[model samples]
Target: MLMRKTAALLLLSLPLALARPMSTLAQAPVQYNVAFPNAVHHEARVTATFRELPAGPLQVRMARSSPGRYALHEFAKNVYDVAATDSRGRALTITRPDPSGWAVTGHDGTVTFTYTLFGDRTDGTYAGIDARHAHLNIPATLAYAEGLEQRPAQVQFAGLPAAWTVATQLQPDAAGTTYSAPNLQYLMDSPTSLGEQQVRTWQEGGRTIELKVLHEGTPAELDAYAAQTQKIVREAAAVFGGMPAFDFGRYTFVANYLPQTSSDGMEHRNSTSLTSRRPLRGPGAIDNLGTVAHEFFHAWNVERLRPQDLEPFNFSQANISSNLWFAEGFTQYYGELVLRRAGIYPTDTEYCQEALTGLVNAMMLSPGAARFSPVQMSQQAPFVDAAAAIDPNNRTNTYLSYYYIGAANALALDLELRARFKTDLDTYMRALWQQFGSQQQNYAPARPYTTPDLQRVLGEVARDTAFAGQFFRQHIYGHQQPDYPALLAPAGLLVRPARPNKASLATRLSFNAADSTATLGTTTSGSPLYVAGLDREDVVLRFDGQRLVGSKAFEELLSTHRPGDVVQLEVRTRTGLQTVPVTLTEEPALEVVTYEAAGRPISKAQKKFRAAWLSSKVR
Candidate 1:
């Protein structure tokens, strides 16, 4: 009797197991057809069809956040005229569930959802469409079904002009009109550009590196830009010891340097979106390359040397991470450093004055750096990274960009390693790439790293656990700044006051010609203005008993005064009029100048150090 009972249970379970595979096999790839019927008004029609869905309401949504960005964009605001129908061509009952998405019931296992998207800004985070081209940042353009994120997706671009072509990181079908992604994550990270673009390709380390530029520049200019870009690529690769094993055996740079585009460079796993209003010639040409060097370096850092906090990036809301200082900051340091290595900046003084000075000043002079550690500053990215707000913020007093903070840290760490440990940042980065970044699995990093992991790697690279612990404690976890003047001495660089003789209020003032008064902007927390009972919107009518008549009047007064001078000001606050005595101080700004430029002697040892630090590493 027991045997018979077991046999009966087995027979019933067999049918359930058989039905599961049948159900999965029936699920079809999600299909999207994008058409630009009203391109002139920056509108496109997109239809997303999800087939063989489970028995329930289909939840469809537009992503709220994009890859490479940490803010909530609410992409659904631009979507309108939404409607849905079932496979049998019968209208489904659609309900407004939330601001970001919709719910369609009675779907009959298949739902075709359609919507109109309006996009005008051309950058890495939003979509832009016009008579000339259509730039689509995937998360800002396509809507997806909730339960079908793991299924394959197909996108087809229809109704293009005769000269238009599509450029993206998505795997293309033989027809060249449609592209496919293994899953929704990959699809959303692939930004597409449709326009008349100049295409250039070269083979690097058994992989194809391509540049697609959409610009009004001549073909010869594009060719020249491409050559410079290739040099950047080679130097970047040498840092990591080689190129990343790019998915699809290729990496692409999708650039749009038209007047209609905004300035942005967003990184993805296998590609980068480079858009700017700056053209590819004259002064703008070199400026454009700076962005290229920055974004391409991200292909190895944030895109693959993955941050555990940012791993599997969320599209529904803002993603925060504590490691952006290393992720973005280190990349910032290398971005300009690579340019110097590529011989673009040529002279050590040029690199020091232009690049290093700004970085050191931002870290050393900012009240924000004094208040928060690098980790805390990185956590604030959601509120400050391209986020929109109406009310004024005291960020100037309380915040410094993680980009600057991290680069400063990178600069210090690199020097410490070279001076003390006899190693450099390149070796540390290569170790990180081998451990956490080189292995790719299912369109993401196989081993994403946490803050602790970063510390461990540094300790290993330096072969000194105690030194690494002290560095992280003081700089990364604590707010103590590195002694920059001491660290830069080995390179024969001097950190000095940019304007030693000039006196300043240390806050920006906007002059109102009608009232012949100057109104202050946000005051630094500990500056002379803040200490003297002045704040934003306070108006100064007179300086040193002289009427402030023009924008230059206050500047002229400052020029005549020394650092230790005192000035009396007639001011109008929100409460009433008053006179205040404020002591003037030397400008806190700092500059990095070569010792040779300062008429100081440089040893052969200093020259060797500077040469090794800035010279090209490419073989």
Candidate 2:
């Protein structure tokens, strides 16, 4: 009787499985065909077709947010002339439900959506199209059905010039003009550059690294740039023990250095989009390379060493993460350090002044650092990361960028680990990579980490739970800064006042050309300017009974005073004119310099430490 019951159940399941069939149950791939009919006018006509839809109204929409960006961008604003049709070429009824999406009915289980996208800006977040080239940032270019995110996608470029080619991380099909993505997340993250480009490729650690540059520079310049980029790539990989296994066994650098390109760098799973108006010569070259180093590091840090909060990135709203301090901040620290390690910054003084000094000063001087922890600052990214608003904000006093604060934290943590644990940040980073990033399930990280997980990993790396807990409690969750001077001592680096004898109000002032009076910009909290009740737009009419004539006069007055000196200031406030007492204080600006530059003898041990800290790890 039991055998008969089991046989009956098996016979029932077989018919259902055969009726549906595995192929019929699977969703068909979303298809996209893009044509640049009005390239000179910065317009690209795009068509996206969705098939095998469920029996309901098809909801199609443009993405309001993009990967690697924390803010919400209204991508639909640039899309217009939308029309939809069913599989039989019959026009479908489309209804507007919101600013970003359309609801279509009467589709025969398929809908073809078409639109004209006008894009004029060339950057990592937006699309740019012109006669010279078409730069497509996917979220800004494509629209998708709401329920079809899990379906694969295929995109093809049409009507390209004879000299033009495509460069993207999207896997190419047998047809050279078409590419494929596993899902909507991968499709949205892929940025494509189509135009005349110079291509260079090399093999590193048995994986291919390619650079495709769209610029007006000579081939020799591109050759030099590619060489420098290779060095940066190797140095970054050395920190992680090796490169992440790219999904397609390759990685790409899509660089646009044309005069019309905006300066931006965005990182993806297997590629980065680098755009700049700066040429690959003179000072601009180094600045461009700095961006390259920064974005390349993200392949390991943010793209894969995943923050749990940012995993499964959303498209309709801002994606907030509490770990940007580790994701972007640590990457920022490594971005500059990699250049130094790669010999781009050859001298200790140059590296200190150009990178380390600025990092420390930004963290130390900002009032935001005193008020918020690294995690708090990371949460504020949605409002500040390329976000646009007409209203003014008090960010100068209330917010410190996670990039600077995190980098400072990294520097201090690195020093502490070396001094106490017989280890360094590289070891900690490698540990994180192995635990969280190395095992790729598909397009995303298999083990995305949370804040507590970060602490646990640090504990493991340092072999001390107490130290890791304390470090996070004091710096990551609690608002406490590290002791910089103490941390730098072993490396023979000094953190000292940048301007020793100068007294300042520590507020920026803009002088009127018509008169000597100066209008103050935002006043730093706790500074003498703020203490005097002076704020933005308040004019300083008189200083110490002398008519404040110009910036020169104000500077001369400041030069005459010392810290602790008090002076009378007549200022025009928003309410009325008033007299106030302003006390002068030493400038809080700081600098990092070598001990030898400070006229001090360095011990051999310190020298060894500095060399080990700054030298390349590319063996």
Candidate 3:
């Protein structure tokens, strides 16, 4: 019966709201015919149609960047075999004006450009094609006319395997083969997964959630995961009062849990794409659920209540935002919390333990946290957030992940709000949802929230503008670290000195068993290794006159020593072999423990605070 219900629901199609452009000029919509005839070659033959083009040089350019990503991908590098044809079946003169676009002339007001694109990567930002199927991130696969970007678009798939299917946020025609998007931005944001799939659906608050999964799991496992995902959706909705108005009266989770695709989870306006190298089974499945919670929450935090800087996302340049600390970091903070609130973490003590152990320790131990503010790291996202690769740089010492900082800041702010104003971060987020997220406003590039807006919102939530300013100045925009030991004390988390008093060079070392060589992956900025001149990728030949065999061997040697102990190391550097003497230091000793408070009895007030913060049920 449940199986029949699920099947029936999957077959049901809902009406989609397509926003028509406000342009007065009469022009035909852009059409794309994508085919994967030779999928084994990992190529997509794409043909783009244009009507009533002006009698001049027309430029068709591939996207240099993607939405939600803050970097330039230069997608045209994979496009080849470009040619233009007129309506009379005559070839038009095509010329490469730049690396990413083609200029064509001598057409009779109608032309079609045909090109071949080779893509093998499967993630949120790139496209992938193979014998089994083709997964498309349209920004990397489709080309658009310079001035025709605002026109409506239609896409049709051809030459796919007979058993394969299509899953996207795009509005499907009655035949279900054709999908439509209001504009290029919406088109690019909608990723299509073409393959065999198992779809599951659940409805809440008059909204339907569709989970389309491509996995190797059995029907029972897939069904179970679908139910679990539905629970997660309900739990997330409980946070912001209710769901954000989904663009099409629905939200889609497009997942490719196969060994072929890379691990990633990206949030879109009406959908999210979740790809992984593993399937949803066993305990590992819980880890992937965290991503689902995170991306789903983005429907409110980023997709709608977005920063002004990222409001009108630019495809030709970087879309850097100064508020990712809140957009991405706060979402991460709540991802785990939502899981805990859903009874996924089992207990409040366990949840607090994981929070302190993972988020708090990371912020406390990260030297970069003290070096860069959360806002500064958010501004630096264009360089670190999957940006184009460059030369070797020291990110460990100089850069901190905004995700880490934002989460820690969220924790701190939540604790402070509860401690000072008797409220929590949820109140602030809910206020934003009502003002910025719930209205379902069309994509407006000029209406992003600014720092002043954030400050105002925080002030309204806490009822103290001065307190909000202090938080922004000290934590968000400035490098003053949050005093976690003091802030988290009332929550029953015990901060204590870690045992072992262990010492090391504090360098991240990777060892190859086949070659018996240990290479430094990352060395602390001022640690023994860095001071001794050990650099990243430097292959260690010997430690203390002994041939270094593995990372374990190196750690065993360090275990025998204490802070301020001198050691000798021989390394193979790019400049050649060099022997350097180094002094070790004590490893990070801050430890977080949950419940019992290190032999101290919990007071009734502290217990009340802890329960209020970690209880699964919302007030």
* Model 3 lDDT per residue over 1-619, tens place: 0011100001111223445444412457777767665567788778887877878988999998887788788999999988999989799999998898899899998888898889999988999877765678889988889887667766565545556677888877778766777677788898888788788888877898889888888999998888778777887887798876676688899899878899888999889989887779987788788889899998888888888888677887778888999999999998888888777778766776665567877788788988989888998888887886758887888888888899999999999999999889888988877777666544432245787788889999999999999999999989888888888888877766565478877667777787677888778777788888777889888777777677778778778888888878888988999988888887765677765847777788888898787665543
Query: Mind sharing the TM-score for model 1?
Result: 0.95
How close is every model to the real structure, measured as TM-score?
0.95, 0.94, 0.92
Report how far residue 229 has shifted in candidate 2, in Å: 0.7
Which candidate, 2 or 3, would have the higher TM-score against the true structure? 2
- Name the top TM-score candidate: 1
Compared to the true structure, candidate 3 yields what TM-score? 0.92
Predicted structure 2, TM vs. truth: 0.94
Q: Candidate 2 lDDT, tens digit per residue, 1-619?
A: 0011100000000101112335533767787767777777888888888888888899999999999999999899999999999999999999999999999999999999989999999999999988888788999998989877766666565556667778899876666546677778988999989888799999998889999999888999889989999999999999999988998899999989999999999999999999999999888999999999999999999999989999999999998999999999999999999999999998999999999999889888999998999999999999998999998789989999999999999999999998889999999999999999998775889899999999999999999999999999999998798999999999999999999978988887887767678898889999999988888889888788887777787788789899889989889999999999998889889999999999999999999989988999999
Q: After best superposition, candidate 1 residue 448: deviation in angstroms? A: 0.1
Q: List lDDT for all candidates, in order.
A: 0.87, 0.88, 0.80
CA deviation > 4 Å runs, candidate 1: 1-26
lDDT against true structure, model 3: 0.80
